[model samples]
Target: MNPTPATSLSALREVLPQLAHPDGSPVRALVVDDEPMLADLVSMGLSLCGWEVRVAHAGRAAVEAARGFVPDVLVLDWMLPELDGIEVLAKVRSFRPGIPALMLTARDSVDDRIRGLAAGGDDYVTKPFSLEEVLIRLHRLVQRTGVMALDADELVVGDLSLNVRTREVSRGGEAIELTTTQFNLLQYLMENPRAVLSKAQILDHVWDYDFGGQANIVELYISYLRKRIDAGRVPMIHTVRGAGYVIRPA
Candidate 1:
């Protein structure tokens, strides 16, 4: 049973609730895929995540969409008619310079991946992929680019600061060592400061929808974050008992 656009979007929201940006606007995305079903599916999923998505089935259409849509991220398919993915990426970057793009292809070779990155893609995904993987990668790209930021390079809660550009975390002017996962988790929490986010919400943003391991993984990571970000400090990260966690200046 194939899902209709409405149903697909609804399922996506059930798994990963889509919250509006801090500024109350949807993040915009440009999805370029030749296959109608795949493109529609991806678009619907993104839309469910509060992203304003525009679909382009061809390389030329993708380039055109970038001009008008001005998306924060671009999900491009490698094989396309009228200018391959690489060429389309080149043109888009020429004007939009540094706009993050995730290239999707059936090409799984190391050399192919390198070429895609060298040709101006921030990330690459091979076909037979999970929609969750795509969404996660897109989130990472957006975070790294500060696409959701409200015109700021730093997100601060209390004395803690997460530098969107340098990818640095510091509390009370002291550098805090964090792994990539820890950094991402902390960033998510700090981005929505004072908001009580549920465990499911944390997992959806920090981990993936298909995380088949222990359900305590979110708790484990929260502990990991506390150790680094809250251990010796004033403890900005707090457990809300029945609710999830929230980062607020204590």
Candidate 2:
């Protein structure tokens, strides 16, 4: 049966911004999921980030792909036919012990999360997740591994610079002070650059996942950020009318 064209994942995908390896070398990724369409969607997203990606629908295939591809990062789904994600992760770890991995699971239990992490998963995401989340999490995971030898800590958008380690944000030649929450919101915005982020997305990322509050809190924080970072200068924080907020180069 053909899915409605407009409702398919392919149709939902927009022109994603590109993210690249710092060394100008090619970055490879392995996406393991039994769901063919989900795997394909994820592969597409990673490819858009200018990374080479391989998709494996089963656990054995995942391990073989890992051996041959030597991917910089792995996105593994917890459930699969034949061998499960944990089994695949264990087998892959045998050879690529230091390889960073992100686990995707439908289970939300604390035990499940701990098991995946104890099994060598460097990060975790639940199923029905956004492709953007996968891309960002995997990007962070790869950076943490130091295999890419990239300057993954510092970020710059035009004149605004953010140092993840120092927690310092600077505008042009001047330093800007920010609260922890404000800093996190700005960091997420800087990570995405020109892309518009919805309030819900911002809440999920900048705020805690279980942060049961309204979008007003995001707006309140954005205002605080604007006052501290953008006031009396070329504004970097912008509101997209009915959409959401974005931080562009000032």
Candidate 3:
């Protein structure tokens, strides 16, 4: 007899331990696709891999979700009803510049892939992709971004100070402690201060991958940093509408 839904859920839970973060937080992902069945399939597969997944059917909805849901990775389709994947990515980058975004599309030409990457895609997966490959790539991206050790040397943006190696952050002389992911994400932003970097660009440089996961991960970490580093303080990380992020002194 086939297992009941509860039994299947329990079985899935048992496997979650193997895929969960060391601290037990569920990895989060967003899926954007115009095709309902394809989006469902992608969400289900990612859920099976222990990701908390959400789906959006249009580019505009995807952008709105990126701001609120703040997923760690985005599985985005190249074509959409209104804005298209490129437009969605551009908008997401404006709010949270360093999120990791994976592009999914039926277009397989080299030029098309280049265009996607140039438009803020960390990675691209063509249609008819293997589920296993997607899982592996996503796993690699999450592990790399979420688990890196930062340098303890101090980083300065005018009077603001951030120590990547020690996970200590401060403005002027006051000190702060940041989560591992937050520290790394902030360090990357500060390191490239004054330069506008999109979420995909951040993922490519900091996470050191071409693609695999949700772009909103950058936004989530940025939120963490804002609370820890910029909250109650003058804003330094500024958003450029329809562009990306730039860190500049107030």
Candidate 4:
């Protein structure tokens, strides 16, 4: 039987019990594909599986949606209009590094997959994929990274402070409201302050097993963290070109 919208929602509801939630917050996802029908199917499948899903038909639009959607995961097609998936992924990495991104493409060549990963994609799914496989992969990815949980005791950086248990962040005694992922990435950076941590290293510590080998994701997330944590304040996180990252007082 073809899965209508109602049937899809019902199926998703049935699987809700098996899926885990992020401490009661809805799991958000962004799907980027030029093919509207394909994007809709993927969105419906994800929605049924208990994800809050949004779709973008082009790379530029995908970036715009991400600012508001703040998606925990991004399902990006390799080929896109205006900007290709790789370009979109690059732009996203500039803004939200460490957010897991799964690439969808009809191109199954090893070179293509390698290019995607090198560009900062966390995972790759070729076209004609099985819904079951995507769901399982996403679950594993989320579980491995633990990106949803924000109940840690505390995060500290050179006298700066973030109490995860209290959801409070302070630099020089001033409080900050960091989104869940930002907090996690910042915490990881603070924990390894002064170490030239690479993007891959950050992704491994911050995202799930489904994270691709691309390093740009780390760069993007660092920018997001810096904007919130260092914009008008002293810089705490610094990027080393051709190397990785280091955290220190500015």
Best candidate (score: lDDT): 1
The full ranking of all candidates by TM-score, starting with the best, is 1, 4, 2, 3
Report the error of model 2 at residue 47, Å.
Answer: 0.8
Candidate 3 C-alpha lDDT tens digits along 1-250 = 1212445545544543233332446777889999898888778767765579899999889999989998878889988988899898889888887778889899899999999998888888998776655666776555434322122365566457666556677776788787666777778887665678888887887677665675777677767777877788887777787677777654
Q: How far is candidate 4 from the true structure (C-alpha RMSD, Å)?
A: 14.8
lDDT for every model?
0.79, 0.77, 0.73, 0.74
Tens-place lDDT per residue, model 2, 26-144, is 67899998889988878876775667999999989999989998887888999999899989988998998777889987866889999889988888888767766676677656644
1 against 2, candidate with superior TM-score: 1
User: Taking the tens digit of each residue's C-alpha lDDT, what string does model 4 give over 124-160?
Assistant: 8897876666766775555434333222465444446
How well does candidate 2 match the true structure in TM-score terms?
Answer: 0.53
Question: After superposition, which runs of candidate 4 have C-alpha atoms over 4 Å from their true positions?
Answer: 1-23, 147-250
Q: What ordering of candidates by lDDT runs from best to worst?
A: 1, 2, 4, 3
In the order shown, the candidates' Cα RMSDs to the true structure are 14.8, 16.1, 15.2, 14.8
Give model 4's TM-score versus the native structure: 0.54
245 Cα displacement, candidate 4 (Å): 21
Worst 10 residues of 4 by lDDT: 143-152
The alpha-carbon deviation from the true structure for residue 86 of candidate 2, after best TM-score superposition, in angstroms, is 0.9
* Model 3 alpha-carbon miss at residue 7, Å: 16
Q: List the residue pairs that clash in candidate 1.
A: none
Output the better candidate (1/3) by TM-score.
1
lDDT of 1 by residue, 1-250 (tens): 1444565445655654343355658788999989999988888778767689999999888898899888878898899999898998899988898778999888889999999998888899998777777877786576554333343667766567788788999877899888998999998887887689988888888886654565598889899999998786677788999988988754
User: TM-score for all predictions?
Assistant: 0.57, 0.53, 0.53, 0.54
